[model samples]
Target chain A: MLTPPETEPLTPEDRTLMGPGPSEVHPRVLRVMSAPLVGHLDDSFIEIMNEVQDLLRYVFQTENQWAIPVSGTGSAAMEAAFANVVEPGDTVLVPTNGYFGGRMASMAERAGGEVAYVDAPWGEPLKPAVVEDAFHQHDPDIFGFVHAETSTGALQPNVPELTDIAHEHGAYVIADSVTSLGGVEFRVDEWDIDVAYSGAQKCLSCPPGASPLTLNDRTMEKVLNRDTEVRSWYLDLSLLEGYWGDDRSYHHTAPITNIYALREALQLVAEEGLEARWERHEAMATQLKQGLEALGLELNPEDEYWLPSLNAVRIPDGIDESALLSDMQADHNLEVASGLGDLEGEIIRIGCMGYSARTSNIELVLYALEDALRNQGYEP
Target chain B: MLTPPETEPLTPEDRTLMGPGPSEVHPRVLRVMSAPLVGHLDDSFIEIMNEVQDLLRYVFQTENQWAIPVSGTGSAAMEAAFANVVEPGDTVLVPTNGYFGGRMASMAERAGGEVAYVDAPWGEPLKPAVVEDAFHQHDPDIFGFVHAETSTGALQPNVPELTDIAHEHGAYVIADSVTSLGGVEFRVDEWDIDVAYSGAQKCLSCPPGASPLTLNDRTMEKVLNRDTEVRSWYLDLSLLEGYWGDDRSYHHTAPITNIYALREALQLVAEEGLEARWERHEAMATQLKQGLEALGLELNPEDEYWLPSLNAVRIPDGIDESALLSDMQADHNLEVASGLGDLEGEIIRIGCMGYSARTSNIELVLYALEDALRNQGYEP
Candidate 1:
């Protein structure tokens, strides 16, 4: 083995993360960031790990015993949900509105599921009636959708109704709450979301790493009774339960420090109260919308269906999108993402998620964008 | 949704870890543990992440473009390797000499590969000749084996020879170097290992959240040209390369703080040359072996094949293993594991790896074990 070459010391600029995810981590969370590392199964670390599980349950609004953070990021959690529930030959109905929904469809397909996509435009929500029609036509075993479409800035409404339709046709609902969980109101149990998974980086005001996943008893039973073993042995909840469960048997080594950061972030959420957190995000998003509208920018989606955490705004004609992002990074030390797939070069996604949901930060980003557009000779 | 009930804080004894992993994390690594949480794609954090990648390449002994850390622990890396390479119906040959080897077989099988195991007992090394025989018989597409068998305490010799056999059969070699990479001598490129992966907690002395994985051009070509899409969307290297490769695109949110700890750990290893680190671990293991033998304890495997990192010693007759373990914890705050699977209760696994590979720690653990065995009515 060779030695790593010497390099410069890490000097982080305090940038407000307002992209799709990895929202600005709270300063308190950052302050506790250097806590001493403890063994994964050590008593103290496991205590914190347990606290994280508890915090995740509270945030997810679920009493499920299997509520725990998946080791990888949000995608890992999504994979875990699909791997456990959608075995080979299972028919899974997936909504294709945003990138993540398409990801769910692809993952389901890979899990050997016959995927039936309930199509929706990129910037539109999945209509409950359309899902009902799909259910009547396909009668799938699982229904999957993104609660908050990060890519298209569309927040699906009538989730409880959609889940009801899925249940009426004997299907479990898998919700991707990656961008919605802590930033917006999500009634997991009330909505009959059999499986809901979230990423910590989005609304938890933490870095991306852990995915908080919760499952109802029905989902767990399905996982238990799966005919074929789950394709991913690593993400298999059965083996992981031994480690994250009461037994605390060795699985893969848990990322101890990342868990600490999530714990701190979740504690901040608890202190703020989940509902209050949602209100704060909503209020800040309103402020951002007002500011962006004041700058004569058009929002991606109309009211009620739009996601509050991530606001996708159409780029005005003749505006250099890449240059605007570069300017934001260089001048304001801010980051806003460009759209993906079809939306690419058409919209700039400005996220007000987690700690970045502050009114001041939103105003700063809006002002910066306004300046960049004007400087680039684009009408704002 | 209900929150998990608040529980009492977990109290952890400061135990000296002596197991396959995670060996005792360096105290300095723990002290620097809580570096401020930065966004995964933050410039400064990305700089650190790049450094970590560079360090990983160093430890992997390769300039392979794909050398980087996977978000999950060691097993996740193993899954990533197989999920990226072994598509459905592909033939994967795995060694079954120890626990990890068996795990590989199961993971590969789940990945839709027809897994063929080259048989060896738990406490024995995989015979190169036998492996070659299996290669001739199966002519497998993928050859997988553990370089260091943690369960059996057997260090597989003849890495070059095995790689030659696999390559001769037109197979790409995926080496599970989890317990060998940093603690022992492993030349990934030299041994013609197409894909190699390792756990950070074992030899790197970092808390286990990430696993380092590397692949040469040969393996990358397989991943790039796979006929079927990789089953796992999360573990898929194609998308991961965008995030970890030069482009630095968004994949999932990486575990930022864990990467920080790993970078620091890798820096420590770099500061102390790789050869020096290997010698340190070897010397520490020799000391432990000498001390154990002096206490009339017998190592499970023959001297020639014993692993330096994980030492499996048979429990002397009439010794209460549980009581001895309990006494070690209660009296000395030391953690030495009981065996895994078939070896359970029949042996005690003592580790001398990474930051735990110190003469003083070995002596302390030895003294504690001696007291524990004597207290359990063993005539030591």
Candidate 2:
């Protein structure tokens, strides 16, 4: 009858956010999140959005003419990228190594495009030569692959080489960097990636709402010259241009508070240079990998293709996975995730991105995991 | 090398949000919003999410079992409804009156459906007879339209009749009640609305991140039995069910703080009684309408179809719209929007929704508009 019990107002339960995303929100970011809500169209808010666009361009290392945050989650940006670039009957080649790449193929299909796949094992990166073979084999209108595979903890290598091969075949490269953007090296312009998108919750440390998207002039020209109107009126970049661009028209109400939090998170990223941030994540990951090995665990992906942001560790033989995870949660208040898609039950994913990429947090999780496994009657 | 100035540190400016949402976030909701972050799968957060589900079911006036807030904006909820139900080559009948209805048709097309329209002029409500004719002519598999036309301030009439007609034709009804849900009377079950989605900022008095969506058993079965995976893996109900349903699997990170705000806002609705909340909006709208008329302005829609949540006032002849808006901001610190889409420069949209539907606020806007209009040289 009364407003649901105030129970406990957010008590800031301190825990290491070591999962695929929603990597721990920085305290500075959280402080900025507490800032007052402003009108979405206020001059101040628009000014902030403009700054976010500029910073995103810097982190992505792109001078793309079109760079903005789409109003929905990372998936919205993914759909927007495909919806804007791929037309009906157009051919799109997608990597079949991870769940996200499959997502691109499906969204492109909805956009009425035919899709061909360049297959790779779940924990392996697509070889650039294999991509070249696919280019010669299918002659796709668009080529796309995941930069960091969140599902399997695999970082695809040879990004620039793949983009070069695609561009040679007259295909635009679309990169899904949801788990890799700020914490890894992404030179969109240098790598010749025509389109790229990432989620706010990952390396940005913002809550998951808006998605950052960037497209070069060549891709923008293709979208501008589309024979048909963009299928989604809400996500249509042309209409969105007025809202995100200089002439702000009322398209839809932006999520104002989420934008506020994102601006703060991106500010933190800029304060720490992108290279420094990448080093932080890499160092923390190295610490966790060493600690886990010392505790008698093996990472699912081989060292050659491992993702630093998210590491998938195989559950040691003769241990109850759920019991161990429960112990970690009930005893340690830590949140590491089980695997998704085909890798469930066999692997555990620990993230080291954004605010969670601290050496101290990694040490805590490793210590807690060792205790939890021992408590579950596993010999470690 | 510096972060954007806007991100330097957020200093929240206090402004009266009188345009379309996001309305001024209620103070209590703001407090709840700053609640410390919790894991999406945390027991405490899920406890809150369950309460949110129960509250949403109550507010939507449905027992459809599948009711949860989609993690994106209102448009994302709209996209979810279509992406789940409309497979490739399906026929979707939509009304073409206001901008939102037009948006539904385009989104349906993007989901790989063919769209047919029941025509209504901008600023006019859809006639049930025209929709019946459309059903007969196009035999659409899905019927989508706006319940409250946000852009034109037209509240479509005869929801029960429309749903009945849609059902008779074996078409699922998708209702866009973004602007009408809490302020206006909406009975998802009573009106036979198979799928209904709404935004929080309108009558819920919260920030806009999560969108409430409800699907009836029939609609749920179709989505469950989809032939092809819903195109956008992110929006696919199959994946979403694991997160929002009883079995909580990891989906994309959710906008957790926004959900807290929505839960608190809906709790306010329950405390005041849904019927009482509707009456408050109606009463305030009456006050606003009377005051605007006294100020010599005309409400654009016919009296019967006018939405109480949104008021459209025709710009007085010889008045410069931009200057009038500028004066409203500078002189009174009031925020209102100029016309959108085809109605540009012809009308001003003043929303008295959610927290903004207060008597004192309405009175303040009335006095401010009077002075601002005269200052801009309007003959009033």
Candidate 3:
């Protein structure tokens, strides 16, 4: 017999999450997490599933019948998009602008697709001409681009133009909307995106489980007619269709509590109209950006492509990024993140997203940054 | 622009969960799920992650040092075990007796492994001689068996004997302990199993995300040195090691609230000693079994291999299985499942697991079954 390790009651410190993701979850969503469980196959739960799909369609602004929540976090949904759409022996064109694009490339490669890159710098969005050139040069069957890069805080502009290029080349387009879906302006149908996926924790103000994913009939058709079996049985959409589609059959247990949380979170989104939510995020982030600029810190992306959900600011000269972040946590119980991938050590990301995108939170972030900078002997 | 769906607030019916899984969750675990969010990489969250791993290790009864929660549900963890350990062209041996083994074969095939099966009847446990014969014929590189068959309520007895055969043949073994981990007697170390995975919703009685998985150093060595990349990036252990291992870096945003729920659930297991908890399940299930027998019902499995956590009873002649289950729910807010796969309409599965394994829940099940059966014109 093994001796059990003595573990204390779970008392995690309540943090003001202002990092790249997992921003403050809404109280309604939190309360929903505590609700009692029902079997995944319960009639009531199937109703809940229908409502979730409908809510997801509203949020993604698409009439695609396949709007559903994937079982894992945002990354699982991201992998599902690539693993289903990019078949074996196909060429997948992915952006080189940020961390998520790199992730898409890895998933595509593992899904047996040959990956080709459309080059862009870390703090910039892909230009339409460059995308056109990549399409012509690579002649890829599938193309993926990050709609809002969480790492660099750059929003891809002219989405319709990029999708147009893909359509003209007869290539399907997949959008990584993890940071932008609910908080920023995005239109899956209007933008002609074949598929788009988002994390619940970021803009939905829900915890990170049961992420949102939507696909048009055209893309799903391609996925359904794939030559090779999808490499991941769990992420394979063909099998998932039996459950999420009209059949309502068993396909593993749905995260019932997480689905409840997401229902509440999306209900909140519906109550406060989508345009209002997007405006609120932009207004809060504008204030946060101004305050950081007032502290002599430069915002990384230009206004044309700046992402309002996540504000990436260049770390001031002589400011230790790690110490600055830890000081914020130690002093204010707040969280902000350092840059990732190509922009590592060059920037600090402060998120103004979903439930965290409020005047009080933005004010707290500004005040905390000022206090930390003063302690670091930096004068503005 | 699409109009938002006028979804009602989340108010799901609070039914008693006594199905094959998602058996009633402990209130403490439910309360923990409502706790506020912290950044996934926060210092506080890192501590929570470590505590979760330690608690999982205690419940799994293994010193394997690699016990951690997969980010998704039970199936994801099951897929992870096969996707990582069974590389391309590897011959994997799986059982043909139950639904989960068929799922294993599918996942193994997706991972590029050619699958061979050891045959057994759906309601019976595997024979050691058959497993040895199958291994000798197939020269398998991996073998997988279910420790507790939820579909048929049969426990795989003589686990040490099964694992010994795999070891002598130089094959790694994976155990699906989904229905047996915390509420039944499962000794990972004593049985010398290389890998085991379970769902939080089952014997652990947490929600259906963030499942438990443990692998010994030997199997992890093969995972780490795989010539081909893991098929699913989200389930990839090598990438997950960066987050759950000593590195404590980012792989993906974990299902945070689910981890909190699992921590509290496992803490309950530690508080009530494992032996006492297992005994409680057995005692409660014994009462349930006797009551069903009094109603002239026969359990599917023989006494020698009956699984106490999930009691599979054969449906009576002329009984409408669907109506009987619905009546239990409609008349009394209770849940029990119909058999899956081979025994699909022939048996009703009543789960006694974790928080659901109690005198009251068991008594309710017996009473509800008797009432529903009486309503269906069955006598005695």
Best of the candidates, lDDT: 3
The ten-residue window of minimal lDDT in model 3 chain A covers A5-14
Instruction: Check candidate 1 and list the clashing pairs.
Output: A33-B34, A34-B34, A61-B1
lDDT tens per residue, model 3, A1-380: 88888777778897888999899998888998999999998999999999999999999999999999999999999999999998888999999999999999999999999999999999899999999999999999999999999999999999999999999999999999999989999999999999999999998999998999999999999999988899998888999999999989998999999999999999899889899999999999999988888888889999999999999999988889999999999999999999999889999999989999999999999999999989989988
DockQ of each: 0.54, 0.39, 0.89
Kindly list the per-residue Cα lDDT of model 1 for residues A188-247, writing each as its tens digit.
877889999988888887766677899888898889888998889888987887988889
Pairs clashing within candidate 2: none
Worst 10 residues of 1 chain B by lDDT: B3-12
CAPRI-wise, candidate 2 is acceptable
In terms of lDDT, the poorest run of 10 residues in model 1 chain A is A30-39
Q: Report the first chain's TM-score for all candidates.
A: 0.97, 0.95, 0.99
Candidate 1 residue lDDT tens string, B1-380: 35445543333345687777778777667655544455676677778877888888888888887888998878889899999989888899988778887788888888889999898888887788899889888889999988888887889888899999988889989998898888899888778899999988888888777789999987888898988888888898988888987878787778776787788888888888898888998898999998898999999999888889989999998888888887887788787778888789899988888988987789888999999988877776
Tens-place lDDT per residue, model 2, B100-130, is 8777877888777999989998898888899
lDDT of 2 by residue, A200-219 (tens): 88888877777899998888
